[model samples]
Target: MEESAILNNSECTRKCSENLSAVEDAIYVIGGKWKLKIIIVLQESGNIRFNELQRNIQGISARVLSNELKDLELNGFVKRVVHAEQTPVIVEYISTDYSRTLKPVIMALSEWGKTHKRNIREDAF
Candidate 1:
C-alpha cells in the first residue's frame, strides 16, 4: 500500500495532504534514482561532461542518462552549456540556482541515512 493511503482520519488526512504536497515538490526535481545521483555528482564538482556523469552513476545506460539530463534541463534544475569556441564543441552540465537549494535537503537526508540505516550483509547485494 502507498503511504498516502494509510492516513485514515480527518486530522491525519490534513497532515497527509501537507506531506503529499511536500513530497510532490521534492520529487518534482529529484524524482528518478539517477536524477538525484546526478545532482549529487554535480554538487561535488561544479560541472561535468556527459561521459563523466555516465561513469559516476553506476548501471545507468547512456540513453537513460541523456533523458534524465534533458528532463532536468527542462525543469530548470540543471543548465546545459555548449562551448562554441572549441574546435569540436563540448557540452557541460551545471546545477541551477533552483538545484543548489536542494543541497541542504540532500545533506540532511545523507545525515539521517547515516544515523538510522540498518546494517545489511554484503552478501545480500
Candidate 2:
C-alpha cells in the first residue's frame, strides 16, 4: 500500500506539471500589461472608436493601442468593426463573447488590488 501510494503521488505531480504548462499557454495568449487593460475598456465601452479608446487609456500611444487591438482581435478576445456608413469610415473595437469569460478573473483581480493597496498603506505606517 505504501509503494502504491508513492506511485500515485508521483503520477499526480506529473499531471499537475502538465496542467501548469497548459495554464501558462493560456496566459501567454492574454498576458501583457496592455492586453487586459484594453479588454477591460472594451468590455465597459462596448463598441468604441479607435480615437476614443486611445483617449480613454492614458499614456498609451496610438501605435501601441493599434498593435494591442490587433493582437486581441487575433486572439478572439476582441472584434473590430468597420462602419461604411460614416463619411470617412469608422472603426470600432468591441470585446468578443469569449472575452466575457474573463469578467470573473478581472473582478477577482480588482478585489485583490484593493486589498493589496490597503495592506501597503498599513505596512507603510
Best by TM-score: 2
Candidate 2: tens digits of C-alpha lDDT, residues 3-43: 99999999999999999998898789888778888999999
Deviating ranges (above 4 Å) for candidate 1: 1-12, 118-125
Quote model 2's TM-score: 0.89
Which pairs clash inside model 2? none
Please list the C-alpha lDDT of all candidates, in the order they appear. 0.86, 0.91
- lDDT per residue as tens, model 1, 56-95: 9999999999999999898888899999899689999999
Q: Which stretches of candidate 2 lie over 4 Å from their true place?
A: none
Candidate with best lDDT: 2
Residue 59, candidate 1: Cα error in Å is 1.6
